[model samples]
Target: MTRSTDRWGVTGTVTATASATRAAAPDSATVAVTALGEAASAARARKRARNRAATVRTAIEATVEVGIETVDHRVTNSAVTFEPETDAAFRAVEEFHVRCEPDAVATVVVEATDGGGGVDHVQFALTDTARADLQAEAMTAAVDRARRKADRLAAADGLAVGAARSITTQPARPGNEPVDDAWESDPSVHPAPISVTERVEVEYELTAAETDMTVANDSGKG
Candidate 1:
């Protein structure tokens, strides 16, 4: 006859999957500023475009924030009007990005756009410290959810929970939805919540049932 000890293996393992989410407030804001100029002469158009860019840079320097940084300031287009009317006319457009303390986003936007610039889009994001903290919480919540589900499933199968045999985790990313655009114009407008979600699939071993049943049956035979 085959012995129960020889048959012991990974049989009757239960797998559980679940996901958890948590919201965190964003700590930084990014804004895009663009400028366009048209002139009767190519030289005049170039000078106006340069002046517009300079105006934006100076405005940025005057603004107060925890800290402000500019990046990717570029000229998108600069050409003379030839197809429509070659009357020595030219047009130019330049764009730049600004990152600053969350609270200062609206003021910086207003000041930068005062020089005939337009806002392209605004993004609110988490700080390093906040991201780490939220990620930890989300993972714990996901694992706990998996454990609870496993317990119920194992009990229904007339088995008890045991050590985890294997586990898989899903990394976190930026929230799926964008923050409110209106917050760009009015800093007082609270941003929509930023969320982090995590998913985990865990396989847990279930205690052997035949071993205990055999002992009971032997006692009855005695």
Candidate 2:
């Protein structure tokens, strides 16, 4: 009887072990399904966030502004001809204005003699600072005019004009520098115009601050 009881107890222990192994298999499968569901949800959320960011980036890139340039110029000239014994005498008078302050000199001696035809010596000097001041004023005025024109253009194009980024002033190219036969024929008659020009380059930033056209309409109504 003792042997039979011991054999029954061993059989019960084996049966219990088999039941627990079968249960564990189903539990593991359930846990794997739950984990896979969580991973899929997380991936979908990440993709949505990336798409939103890409849309904003595209909008900003489209609203960037382009740069523009404006220019202004003014030119004037003076003539001086004298009966000097030699070319050297007229040249000396012209040289006098070289060291003199631009403000002090009114007349600019161009040449000592008209080499084209046997004429008396001539001298021409560019009036210094005082005359340049007048030209500078004219140039500044021209710049203002250009700015107005730019404003009108910006308005027409639906753009906003920003402050000037840079400004430059350059003398007009001298007519004498060009050896056109037409100009040489009457060098005295065709004196080079003294020129003062102003140029500016400006940068403007453009943006479509909101996607909703309603925002623009609200602003207008307000």
**Per the 3 Å backbone cut-off, how many clashing residue pairs does candidate 1 have?**
0
Give the distance in Å from residue 124's predicted Cα in candidate 1 to where it truly belongs. Answer: 1.1
lDDT of 1: 0.68
Model 2 global lDDT (CA atoms, 0 to 1): 0.28
What is the Cα-based lDDT of residue 199 in candidate 2? 38
Candidate 1, residue 38: the lDDT equals 62
Candidate 1, 89-203: lDDT as tens digits: 5665666777776787777777877866777877788877887787789878988999999888876665666788888986544553323333545656767667778888888
Candidate 2: tens digits of C-alpha lDDT, residues 74-127: 111112334433332112110111122222111111211211111122222343
True-vs-predicted CA distance for residue 209, candidate 2, Å? 13
Task: Write down the lDDT of every candidate, Cα atoms only.
Answer: 0.68, 0.28
